[model samples]
Target: MLRSSNPLEPTTASFGATDIPRKPNYDFERREREKTKAAESAKKAQAKAEKRAAEKGASDADQSGGS
Candidate 1:
């Protein structure tokens, strides 16, 4: 019974296949959770890289100072 000028829009014709209202398939909650997780992961990786670089720089400085 959905009314729309666009014939492409969903109607009772496909009602048997879906139970939920027809709309874009986007899970905002899931996307937000994923985005948060990704940001945390990126932060952890950056912290690790910085720590490694700092260790390397310290080692280089120590070696130069000894010689």
Candidate 2:
């Protein structure tokens, strides 16, 4: 058997994902994106609310102690 001289060539699998046909669904994709964004926003808001509550409690304690 003859050996190949160019062994540095990249194979098809090394080029990343395989070719696959996908149907474009703009409405579905938009809804999914909106859901993800809303969930993230809600998580951030909850964390912010908790932080604000903690800060407010600490401030109240400090004020009452000084009185």
Candidate 3:
């Protein structure tokens, strides 16, 4: 019973089916959780690597300075 004059606007006949909204897949939540977990793991690995490298650089500098 919509009174819109434009054809582009949704009318009463289609019942909003023509809008074509995306429906999420059944595994979407699981997939998203896995993706988040992977991202967090990668971030932690990168941080650990950076910390190790900084420690190694500091130790090397100290050894070279003492000589």
Name the best candidate (by TM-score). 2
lDDT score at residue 17, model 1, on the 0-100 scale: 81
**How high a TM-score does candidate 2 get?**
0.67
Model 1's C-alpha root-mean-square deviation from the true structure amounts to 9.1
Lowest-lDDT window of 10 residues in candidate 2?
9-18
| lDDT (0 to 1) per candidate | 0.88, 0.87, 0.90
Instruction: State which candidate, 2 or 3, has the greater lDDT.
Output: 3
The model with the greatest lDDT is 3
Model 1, runs deviating above 4 Å: 1-26
Clashing pairs in 1: none
Per-model TM values vs. the true structure: 0.59, 0.67, 0.62
Candidate 2 — which pairs collide? none
Query: Which lDDT tens digits does candidate 1 get at residues 4-62?
Result: 89888776666558567766657987898899999999999999999999999999999
Global CA lDDT computed for model 1 = 0.88
Tens-digit lDDT track of model 2 for 1-67: 4345677755444466656888899999999999999999999999999999999999999999999
Overall local distance difference test of candidate 3: 0.90
